[model samples]
Target: MSKIYVLDTNVLLQDPHSIFSFEDNEVVIPAVVLEEVDSKKRYMDEIGRNARHVSKLIDRLRETGRLHERIPLENGGVLRIELNHRSFHQLQEIFVEKTNDNRILAVAKNLSLEEQTKENGRAVILVSKDTLVRVKADALGLQAEDFLSDRVVEVDHIYTGELTLYLNTDLLNRFYEKGELSLSELANHPFYPNQFIVMKDALGTSSSAIGIVDHIGKKVKKLVFNHDHIWGIRPRNAQQSMAFELLLRDDIPLVTLIGKAGTGKTLLALAAGLLQTEDLGKFKKLLVARPIVPVGKDLGYLPGEKQEKLRPWMQPIFDNLEYLFNTKKPGELDAILAGMGSIEVEALTYIRGRSIPEQYIIIDEAQNLTKHEVKTILTRVGDRSKIVLMGDPEQIDHPYLDEYNNGLTYVLEKFKDQKIAGHIKLVKGERSGLAQLAADIL
Candidate 1:
């Protein structure tokens, strides 16, 4: 049976192509939702861009037939603009305000009632990204759902980019002696190219061999980087060791680091970038950037130039650099940065439309970016350049993005199988004992 889905403004803003995802179901866009979308069409942000795209999409659909009345969709469904908004009296008592959300709820309630009165009627569902809106819809006796088209995978089930398997005690010794083990000998234990593997002794002893899968060789070879220090920063854990091997490899151009705040994701990236750029001269510059989304309340406006205004936002990057630079005085790190001149701190806004060539680009807090934004950043990479994305999915600041839908997680899932990409989910927090407690308990 066909269903009617009343889309919320957030749903439209989250995905401009959501209307066509219903698959033969009726799609209704409430007038109040359009009002809200129009209000946001001038934002100059991702939401504004999406709002305009949605309007253009709707207007283009008008060419086929009238939207106010039911029109045939390319899919087997019908699209309609719900201009007949019922009175707010039904919602006024419950919400006590004529807000856009309230009006949207009112529309869904009215549509539900009308559908109930119709014989052989379909279900009326309100799809939204706002949790409160869905809760209110449930209170008002309406079916509500979250938009799930872009969600690739759940947080807990995200790919780890590594695998551990028990092997015969002799295989570990052979791997250690010969420096590699054939994948065919593992008997169908599947592994992706560049995937990290730990072959433990079958006796469950402490003996093991750590290597990465080489698909060309049909074997898992010893890691090129083994507990080595990059720019004075060494891996503190097994996961970090795995990450370092991927980061230092010239074959893999894309690496993703997923971890919580104190997991050294950004620090390790900065270290490798510094080593590759300043020491090895592999890349021309080390460029670091992150999304500018505010965490809690906005500070309104700051008083300064672009770089000065970015100081607070980029302080985390500076802190990691300072620790690496071992800067003790107030201006020591600044002097070091000025002398090197190879490190460039930038905003994600400026990264668009520019092709960055021969640079080691590290995008931190990548979980705050959309999939489209990720594509834009990746395409900016020129020849001989490498891009590393690092973020903790749980610490996302983007309003519409979540662990499963954010750019960082999206990249991890999409590129896990690719030979040119490697990812590591850092599980240990190295900031401090207290910080680890906070990450685990708080």
Candidate 2:
């Protein structure tokens, strides 16, 4: 049976193409949702862009037929703008506020009641990204669900970029002696290009070896820079070693590093950027950027010039740079960056529409970006340019994103099968004992 889905304002803002997601079902957009979307269309951020996109989509649909009435969608679904069910009598006692959320709930509740009287009643489900809205919907005895069409993988099942295999002692020893093994030796298991593998003895012995699948997915090769340090930073764990292998390789232009707090993701990327751009001269410059999403209550309207205003937001990047450069004085780091004239640090907002060729780009805190935003950033990559997107998926600050659907995880899963990309999930926190304990338990 075809069901009826009521879309919340956040659903459309999260994904403008959500209208076409429900196939062969009826999608209802309460009138108040339009108002909320209109309110957000004026801002200069991702949310504003999404809101405007939604408005344009709805406007284009309006040209075909009246939105207030049932309109046929391209995907065999029915779309309608519900305007008559705004009455809040049923929710007046429980939810007194005439806010847009309550108004949306009223529409869903009324539709549920109206459908139940018919012999063939379709189920009414309220779809939203807000957890509190779903909770309040359940309190009102309405069927509510999270908008899950954007999720690439479940949080528990997210790819860790590494796999463990138990091999016979002979095969393990052969792999170590030759420094590489053909894909035919590992035919029993499937592997993606550049995926890290830990080969252990099948007989429960202490023998083990670590290697990465080649770019063609046909061989397991030893790490090239497993021993060498980059920019005075060495890999402290197996995962960090794997990250270096990916970061230093010019053939693989895209790399993603996912980890919790203090996993050395940003540090590793910056170190590799410095090594490649400054020491090796492979790239012309090193460009580091991050999305501007505040954690807690934002300190509204920071006072200063452009760089001064950005200093607070970009301080984390500066801290990593300071450690790498060993700058002790207050203005020493700024002088070093200026003197080098090869490293550039800026926000992600100013990166659009620029052709960045022969540059090493690192986007820190990438999990705060949405799918569209990430795509925009990736499309900016020019010839001979490498981009590394590193972030902690669990530490997202974007209101509409989560661990499963954030830009970092989305890219990790989408490029897992490709040859030009590599991913590593750092498990250990090398910052300090206290930071690791907090990341584990807190």
lDDT of 2 by residue, 375-403 (tens): 99999999999999999988988989999
Judged by whole-model lDDT over C-alpha atoms, candidate 2 comes out at: 0.93
Model 2 steric clash pairs = none
Query: Whole-model Cα lDDT per candidate?
Result: 0.89, 0.93
The list of candidate 2 runs beyond 4 A from truth reads none
lDDT of 1 by residue, 1-442 (tens): 8999999999899899999999998999999888989999999889999999999999999999988999888878899999887578678888898888888889888888887898987899999999999999999989999999879884368988888889998888888899988888865866788888878888979998788888563889999876576778888988999988888899999999998879899989999899889999999999999989898999979899999999889999999999999989998998999998999998998987899899999999999999889999999999999999999888988889888898898998998888899888899999999999999998
Error of 1 at 11 (Å): 0.7
Q: What is the TM-score of each candidate against the true structure?
A: 0.97, 0.98
